[model samples]
Target: MSLVNAANRFLPSDTPAAFVADAQRVAVRGERVITLSMRHAGARQVALRYELVGAADAPVVFVAGGISAHRHLAANADFPEKGWVDDLVGEGRALDPANRRLLSFDFLGADGKLDAPIDTADQADAIAVLLDLLGIEQLHGFVGYSYGALVGLQFAIRHAARLHRLVAVSGAHRAHPYAAAWRALQRRAVALGQLQCAEDHGLALARQFAMLSYRTPEEFGERFDAAPEVVNGRVRVAAEDYLDAAGAQYVSRTPVDAYLRLSESIDLHRVVPSAVAVPTVVVAVEGDRLVPLADLVSLVEGLGPRGSLRVLRSPYGHDAFLKETDRIDAILATALRTTGETA
Candidate 1:
């Protein structure tokens, strides 16, 4: 059955935003009013966007990724063949959609609910509520990358009984000081843009910094040769052209307020790994500068007996999850085996 049919049968919502359906996608809006601080804002209404993929009776596997990532988890008409994990997840692939239904949602603190600064715990709570609303009492497993992985950590801690196995790739339980500093600079750039009545420019500037942090020196050295833009055989700092284009594209679609709220919330998020009862795998990229090796090692040690860590050597740095396919698939293979699909 299509997601629209499934939601109509289970959700029964009449609101337009509650169910935004079309020929290509079935998107749902999870609405709730959060009681915020009276000093600033007493309460705020939030509508989280989500999408479900695969069969009705299949075991559910929750998937989440970066901040900009939305609910398009696979190759649909709207997304063409560029779903975030399009290569790793499919029929006969790791966490095959044919065997396990996939659930994905937009990270809160984005455009939908910019009023409150939420922690990853809030994101986890939203996941629990979404699963309950969907009538999914339990999940076969949970997989998250980057920001999604942090949410997965919070989920494992907050809802230990909800899933059998967990997978977190290229995410840290706690924000690193160095990483926070870089993000702070990015936020600062955005704040400046907000202050100057040029949020679009701010957003683009922030993205430039982000692009650098997301990538590794190896990639730049191999691809761009650390040079400027070369147009018509004219070299004028091409990296600037790339950053400009990237930032411009990001700001064009993303809301400035939402970016500030979500990026700042990430810095405030913290979790006690030892408190996590669910069996978990913490995957780290060796070249990832955004998250320190010490931090990942600490997370594994904190996992106690049921916890283990896998460090994949790659030149992709923090973006390894998107680049190193075979390695990521191998890790997912273990998670699938460990989670023991019930469908």
Candidate 2:
């Protein structure tokens, strides 16, 4: 039986009815959650919730995004909620499921209680295991954005034979020191929140801070240049409200511990670009403060002739991959059309 169908049989008798009901609902949507024993040091096992959509004999393409993204890539008959990257995939989209098998899964430390550190290598290994389980021997391409790009690079480095091409968007071989510093402060904020017994508040604060780095000063200046106003006896800038809303929305979906683990994972991520033999298309946004253009240039150079760089200009900064859909879709089409041979 598929994992989703068999999951209920193993649930403890005392399991909440709501939990069981949710599982059944997911099964109806054709989403599968399977537990895998991990070989990594920090984690013993992880349950990966994944969705495979498309023709039975189509080429498989692995798609991933930042820490916040899950397996659902688009809305369909079973799933009504719009996907995180619905603009880039779906019917008549760049990665249309009608012709391609799209594979995506949740990150291992996404549940907020892993307690163990998760390396990108662990994520790569988990993908390999899932592919083995599904009897997929090779992937036509791996398209990853942000943190997912880091994991894609690791996958290409460790499992080069299993992949044909890679499209890494808004990510680099290592975290920029400035970006790492920002993440460190975010973690400290969460730690402070824990000590104060206000974990969610801390997480929200951290997310608010993250929004600053994820976007550019130019964008902020354009969007929040209005005069500060006094509200409830306190002066507030237009930007503060935007950041607060972003933080609150983030906290509603993300757990405090999950944020901490994934934030650390981004800083801990390191890969030797030269080791990646797969043909790679590196997409960098002009004003992405999180992943500097210089770092991406260095990454492409390090890969020698195996990698090609594509630069795009956007006011959205690091979020260009999510906002500049037309441009990203074009890049995806070109990259996916190429063979595994080095550029």
Which candidate number maximizes lDDT?
Answer: 2
Q: For candidate 2, which ten residues in a row score worst on lDDT? A: 23-32
| Model 2, span 1-343: residue lDDT tens | 2222233243332322233233321212222344555434543656655666665556789999998887777765555556778899866566877667788877777766587677888889889877776567999999999999999999999899999999999989999999999999999999999998999899999999898888889889999999999999999998998988898888878877778888888988999999999999999999999999999999999999999999999999999998899899988988886355232
TM-scores, each model vs. reference: 0.84, 0.88
* Local error of candidate 2 at residue 14 (angstroms): 20
lDDT of 2 at 277: 92
lDDT by candidate, in order shown: 0.74, 0.81
Model 2 spans with C-alpha error above 4 angstroms? 1-43, 338-343
**Candidate 1: tens digits of C-alpha lDDT, residues 1-343:** 2222233244323224223322123333344434332212334555555667665556778999877776666674333435666777776667675566678876766653465667888788878877766667887888988888899999999899998888988888799989989999998998898898987888899989999988888887787765456679977874676777888778766777677777877788788889888988989988788986678899999999878899998888888888888789888877766344432
**Backbone steric clashes in candidate 2, count:** 0
Which residue pairs clash within candidate 2? none
Clashing pairs counted in every model: 4, 0
Please, what's the RMSD in Å of model 2?
A: 6.2
Candidate 1 TM-score, true structure as reference: 0.84
